[model samples]
Target: MEIKIIVDAMGGDFAPKEIVLGAIKALKKDRNLKIILVGDEKLINPLLEQESSDLNVEVVHTDQFITMEESPKAAIKEKSKASINLAMQLLAENQGDALVSAGSTGATILSAAKFLPVIPGIERSALATVLPTARLHPGNHGISLLIDVGATLHCTAKQLVHFAYMGSYYVSHVLEIPRPRVALLNNGTEETKGGEVLVKTYRYLKEAPNLNFIGNIEGTDILKGTADVIVTEGFVGNIVLKTLEGASEILKHAGRYAYRKRLTWKVGLALLSSGVRQLKKRTDYSEYGGAPILGFKKLVIKAHGRSNAKAIANAIGVARQSVEQNIAEHIGDSIIEFNKQHRLDFIDI
Candidate 1:
């Protein structure tokens, strides 16, 4: 299948340069891959020439683009021709199968909301990141899908249930997990914890047909790899994601500190160098490519703003994989089935 992907060439710190290089790399990797780069032609076209410009690619010249500092609302309104906004517009127009952007996440999400239609019965979209876990799954991958990493911060129990379904289908499709175990992130594993919203969400997911609900899991249990999908509100989910990111760096700093303070510690780290490298490789956010903003008709992958060419290429691969797997269609089917089974207007029990 010739998968078409739209790239926001003006996104990220590196902008047109790295983004153009990454798109060329992806094109060279897959002969059937077609890419549309949206940015200023002067900037992007020159980068294309720097790399292999003969690959299957097109440049959609746009002088404007959203910056990280700009608010999503204002950027979309003020800059209709902005790279990120135009990328979303192209995806909505079926100009591409998927869109990948290392731009402002807020701009991406808000633009997606304005352009793409949410999956039927899904009240709002959610941002999901596939985080590393301690144990490997049937696919031999140590990762779990964490939903609502920053999309819909304040969510109701009904919406969490929507997220659960969204995350489940996504994991099953993209991660190749058969019957991925779903769990609610709460203060405790007990069904009674996490106040009324979580409690109600627990009950709803527990009874959700075709869902592999595994009850609740604590923050400590996240990396334990007990569950394949962790469902939570954007606020808590974002905190957990960021904490994990910081904690990984903290461990590195701690090792360096100990190495400087004690010769014995340095020797120990040297002995465990292979394992340390492995751990670092597994925890690296760049390896995951990008986070997928789910529930939209067309998939939108939000790569890190500081992404380099390699990371951008990986994100393109993820977007292609999702498009090939028909993730959005499957998720919509699941949501339709869920709404038919339960009237989740609000779960206030």
Candidate 2:
């Protein structure tokens, strides 16, 4: 099956250059992949002419753009023809199988939710990102999904459980993880720890026969390969993500400072530079490209604002995988079964 991807060329900081280069790279790698770059054609086409390739890439002209500081609702309401909006519209119309953008995260979420909608019974959508964990057991060396990394600010106990279910389904189908284990982020491994929400969510998860609930996991457990899926509200998850990013930056700065301090330390730094680069690569979310807005009608990936060509290419790869896995169909089916077995009306509050 040919995979069609729509790229919002004007969505990110680098605009057409990074997006166009990424599309070119993806097309060069995957012959069956087709990409539609949505942006101002005048600027994009001239740039593409310089590439001088026979790749399967086309441009769709869109004059509207949503800025980072603009209100999401206001931008969508005023600029109906925005590049992000049109890219999503193309996805809905089946003009493209998936959409990718290194645009405003808030605008991306709001536009995707409003235009693509969510699977029935899914109260809200989440941004799920894959993270690398310490390899403990065989077949556990790959990445795992972290839900609500930066989406829903607050959630109920039931909603967290629902996030777990959705995360499990995503890991199973899209990531090909069989019987994925779900865990709640907590300060301790004991069931008695955490706040009221975590306690209630832990109890509810225990009753979910379909999921492999692994009790509570501490913050350190996340990097130790303790569970395949970690569920938490956006507030805490966002803090963890940002802190990791900040710590990485601090480490890089410290390495440079040490390297400049003395000759012996400079030699040591040179010896460890490769290892440091590898460590940074593993911890960086840009390598994963973007987080998918799970439960949406169409595959909508939100890339980082500082995304480069590599990140954009990775996002395209994720979109292609999601399409091949039939993620939308799987979410729809799972919601139906969940609703049939449980009364969702009482929990919709």
lDDT per residue as tens, model 1, 1-349: 7999999999999987888888888888999999999999988776777665468998888899999998888989999889888888999999999999999989999999999988887888999998888874443358889999999998888789889988988788877888899999999989899888888899889888889998999998898888889999999999998898898779878988999998898899899999988988887767887999999899999999988888899999999999999988888898888787776444442
lDDT at 103 for candidate 1? 93
By TM-score, the best candidate is: 1
Predicted candidate 1, C-alpha RMSD: 1.9
User: What local lDDT score does residue 143 receive in model 1, on the 0 to 100 scale?
Assistant: 87
lDDT values for all models: 0.88, 0.83
Candidate 2 per-residue lDDT over residues 1-349, each given as its tens digit: 7899999998888887888888887787888999999999988888788875787888889888998889988998899999998888888788998899999888888878777867777787888878888887565755778888877989888678778888998788777789998999989988878888888778778877588998998898877787899999999888887886787689879888988999999999889889878877887777876878887778888888888888889889888888898887777776666656667533643
Could you tally the backbone clashes for each prediction?
Answer: 0, 0
Candidate 1: residue 50 lDDT (0-100): 69
TM-score of 1: 0.94
| For model 2, the run of ten residues with the poorest summed lDDT | 340-349
